[model samples]
Target: MLRAAVIGAGHIAKQHLAAIDAAPGVEAVGVCDLSAALAELTAERFGVTAWETDFRRLLADCRPDAVHITTPAATHLAIAKECLEAGSHVFVEKPIATSLEDLERLAAVAESSGRWLVEDHNYLFNDDVQQLLRLHREGRFGDVLHVEVQVDLPLFAPGSRFVDRHAPHPAMREPLGAVSDFLTHLSYLANAFVGPIRSASCQCRRDSPVATGAISEFKALVDAAFGTALLGVSTGGEIDRFRIRVDGSRLSAEVNLFEVGAILTRTRGGPKPLIPIRNMVGRGFSELRNARRSLSRKLSGGPGPYEGLWRLVAEFYARCDRGEAPPVSLDAIREVGRWVDVITHAACDNATVSERQPEAVGP
Candidate 1:
């Protein structure tokens, strides 16, 4: 069995630990956190024998085949490089790296080390996402013409939407806040169906009260193989919804990533009365499929529903087991990173443009 270690003990780290335990042919060798208490607690909960506050010691002692870096975006590069140099494969949380330079640098080290460096772009592995891709492949949605992604999550309680003193979300005050952390998911999902982006335009605003000087709402326009799509994100939304709509040549589809639901409709180029009947039939089939997936997740005793954390971890270890290249390509990582840079530049005022451009960086 391959051994695995988790470096960060944040909210996301728990998911990694659990997935590691459930993954076949993989064992949770140890866990490391900045806080000794947290590290010990997590290790005990997972029945792991090793736990330490010092990451350097954890790597030297545990000698794991793979390391999952679930720390914040800021510390990913350093920890990942250390893990790679220590002769361990790396399973990292996303956005890969915040800046283009850091991503390129990490890609460089990871390559030279001859190790697998995979990112937890987990939602793309969800059953809902897979079904959507299947529909496109089956010619149900002939030629994705255009698509739009709308992600809405409430950042605070109903009474307090915004405040300068007490920011609702920890990310509000951070450099890009949710823009960098959450939007990356949407961007990658867009790539799954929309194809590679050509150009992008971004707009951000403070939609709530108080003078926090944080951007709580934003939108991006991307020109891509699916033509163009409007990407929307609102932290002040009343409803917590993660949905993307694709307008294709033959049919249109609305998919909810969080709930693992999808609805496809064939509207245009069809007779007036027949369209309603067709949509009714389509909705029935969609509901049936969603119900089956939800039930399967509940009984499978795997990681939680539609999260796909378990599936992603399993795939990463499988690659490590076979001594193969990373499942996700570095080119795809660079494309997503490049678009994020462009959007953040266009959103913020007086943002410094990067002198170095993104290139193909991998082993």
Candidate 2:
């Protein structure tokens, strides 16, 4: 079994631990966090042998074959680099690195060290989203004309370290914002289904305390090689929702993340068109409505969707082991890094004007 250590015992770290436990041929050997107490707690809870406040100590002592970096956005680059240097494959959380420069450096380290580096854009692991990608690739939707994506979720509570109260720390604020945090999933989805983006433009606004006047709503128009797409992202709402609509000549497919299912509608150039395909994957929370449903069945069930993500990571490492090509190449990650830079810069500039213009508006 591949021994893995997780860095950062934060909220998302637990989810990573659960996914790691679910993945076959992998074991959690150690855990590290800035808070020694939290690290100890996580290690004890997960039945790990090692725990430490300093990740370097864990790297040297525990000597895990792989490391999962789930720390804050600002610390991703340094931690990932350290892990790579220590001869461990690294799995980093989303928004891979704060800057393109750091991203390039980490890529170089991974290349030189012959270690696998995988970025966790977990949305790609969602079975429904994967099915959508497959159907789009199979041409079930016909020639794609345009794509639209919408994502909105609640933010961390006030005074949380996640929400910066003072001047924006570019690294922390840029990637953690609604546009980068949530909409990047759509961006990745768009790249997966549509072609490479040629050019893009966006307009955004920040309206609430959750985001602390950070950009909460963002709308973007992207020019893809195949066609164009419109992306809309928002937070500061009571609901957590996501939707993707792909329009085509013969049919259309709509996937609702909140509903956990997809619907395909077909049409012909005649009266009374037909709705051909309607497939539902998960229970859609219908089981939650019934008190009789067993919690064990609901929780411990279903082919774990994150298995594919683990497989992807494992394939990356196997490639490294065999001197084969990395599954998600550095070139691809660099391209992603470039797009993230553009989007982050655009959002920052827009937020500055939006903040100032409001005071300039009236008295």
lDDT of 2: 0.69
lDDT (0-100) at residue 278 of candidate 1?
A: 79
Report the number of backbone clashes for model 2: 0
TM-score for each predicted model, relative to the true structure: 0.88, 0.80
Model 1 regions more than 4 Å off:
158-170, 267-272, 284-302, 349-356, 359-363
* Poorly placed runs, candidate 2 (over 4 Å): 156-172, 209-212, 268-327, 350-363
Give me candidate 1's TM-score against the actual structure: 0.88
Model 2 agreement with the true structure over 93-157: per-residue lDDT tens digits: 77687776777778878888888787776666565677777877788777887888888665544
Per-residue CA lDDT of candidate 1, range 224-279, in tens? 76677678888776887788788888888887765657887886657888988979
For every candidate in turn, the CA RMSD to the true structure comes to 3.5, 7.5
Indicate the worst ten consecutive residues by lDDT in candidate 2: 354-363
